[model samples]
Target: MGTSGDLPDGFGPTIGTLGEDPLVAGVIERYPSAPWLTVGPGDDAAVLDLSGSRAGALIACTDTIVEGQDFRRDWSTARDIGIKVAAQNFADVAAMGGRPHTLLVSLTTPADVPASWAHELADGLAAECSRAGAVVAGGDVSAGTEIVIVGTALGSLATPSAVLRSGARPGDVVAVTPGSGRSAAGWALLRAGLVSSAFEGLLSEHRAPVPPYPAGVEAALAGATAMIDTSDGLVRDALRIATASSAVLGSSVVLDLDPGALAASDDLLRAASALGVDAAAAAEWVLTGGEDHCLLACFPSPAVVPAAFRVIGSVLAGDSGVGVRLGGKPFDGEGGFRHWS
Candidate 1:
């Protein structure tokens, strides 16, 4: 196995016993304390000061990314993986109209993996947390066959109550943050091995997606009826809101997306052409591409929608089951990425 010296700068020396490992020590040093943390890393557990929360409510969500499943080492660096994991976890809190506060990460890696990889991973996690105004309070490490990262995010509701997916009404207007399909388009370009500089923007998005973290709280403050993080895909996450709202409202709700409003961007079209596919294929990426981690929200009216979000669809009363329609027509194509096909 390679030592930390074999890795990049700031990676420090090779790994030793867990208690004496420089990598673990480096991570602890990077994330010492935060305003909300009463007790930071180094102890058996961390303590938080939630008494100052106006709502006295804490929002929590956890997500895991596996080596072969969620990402590929050849496709992304350890730092990129860390940023992605932290982004997705924090996005969940933002989706619920909360302010992200702290994160707990559990990392499992093979013994042969370089200690610097772990150090870079911690740096990445801390970077993303800093972007979200949060900190890595504590976590655990274990040996495994492949790298796996499990992140749990803690947040406080900005509003009196957390916004939920089940709050959308028939008259609600659906909106989303900008740059929805760039990550998916980037993935397509990567899968095709098209490393042209023209698509570098898209490729970067895939490696380290910059989710609109503030939009969630803005939507909540602007009177959003319901919300979700677009980690899965646009249409699929939209359907999630529709279905959840349907059950609560005792009626089938449909999200009628405006095709013109959700049209593919020039970059996606270019990617599609490079891949020798039709424009529809590019449009599909916009519709079904996941990992953008943008927010999809429903507001009571278009006028109430926040400036950060653009109106893309509207909620309608459905006849039988909850569903989605593009331009008032049934979408027959497959939805976004699924765990098990």
Candidate 2:
């Protein structure tokens, strides 16, 4: 059976890897825009220019993180959670081939939680925003039983182009920049009581998913027609892009992965195995699990596949509906994390 791939390090976020998280494809489809708008939610952020020219126009996006649902106070620290909240949102901005410019954060927390958490959160936001070449423009605070973080990002394409998910076509080689699965492994460790520094290092990844923004921009420049992040399992996520772009994606093909990532993954799996958890099954946590915030993308030509990426599959024309195909047939295993099931 065809197995979903671990996203490589460089390509931008894509539905091919992440499946559907935050907002599904239908949501973006609902909000079509005019030319003057420039970019829309379907890409990274929304761009609008009072000026007719697309050059030097402004682009922006808004994303949120909720407690109990998006994150757990027990698992993540105030600072890490804060940074993670901002980092992933900002990654979305980069995914659209937009440069991150500014961020606005809104926080909610229980009365008993430490107030220092907010400051720590701000620090993390500042660090990540600065790293992304963006600034913390503004923010707000409120109260609630669980923690919630809302971030808004502002950016610029400098020229006015939004990298979309439905651009993949037949003959296009599918490749990913980097691999994503560490977070799922780390999360599995935490769930398995292996919360030691030796094992839970992936917790850092889970808290703050490092999406290769530059890689995404590079992909766009390198004829990456379609892009997405691995927020869901590979099969499920790639299918979304295939269905949208009318192409087929397979994970059984040769795909490159970071040695460090592979090593880290092996360790996590070993620990999970000792805990009676399926390390291979745990691999699917990120493969199929949502919230890793990794990027997945499609390249128009094999030349566009960078050294960091591997040719995981190809976009085929014929019928719509993406799936895990191995040996020219549908490969099914772990479906994906279902909501409310």
Best by lDDT: 1
The local lDDT score (0 to 100) that residue 84 gets in candidate 1 is 93
Q: How well does candidate 1 match the true structure in TM-score terms? A: 0.93
TM-score, one value per model = 0.93, 0.73
- Model 1 CA deviation exceeding 4 Å by range: 1-20, 53-55
lDDT of each residue in 1-341, candidate 2, tens digit only:
23346533323232233333322332233222345555544445445554654355466778788886667767887678767877777777766767776676666666555434554566677677667766665555565666778998877663346777777766677766554566676666666666777765577777777767676667666767777766665556666666666423332122222222323256656766766866556555545666566567778788867565556667665432224453355544255544555
Give one digit per residue, the lDDT tens place, for model 1 in 1-341.
Answer: 36754655534534443333556777788774677688998889999877874345889899999998788878888889999999999999999999888899998887767677777788899999999999998899887788889999999889898899999998899999988888888888888999789899998889888888899999999989999998888989998898899999998988889999999999889999998999988888888888889899999999989899999999999987537899888663366878887
Native-vs-model 2 lDDT?
0.61
lDDT of 2 at 322: 27
What lDDT does model 1 reach? 0.86
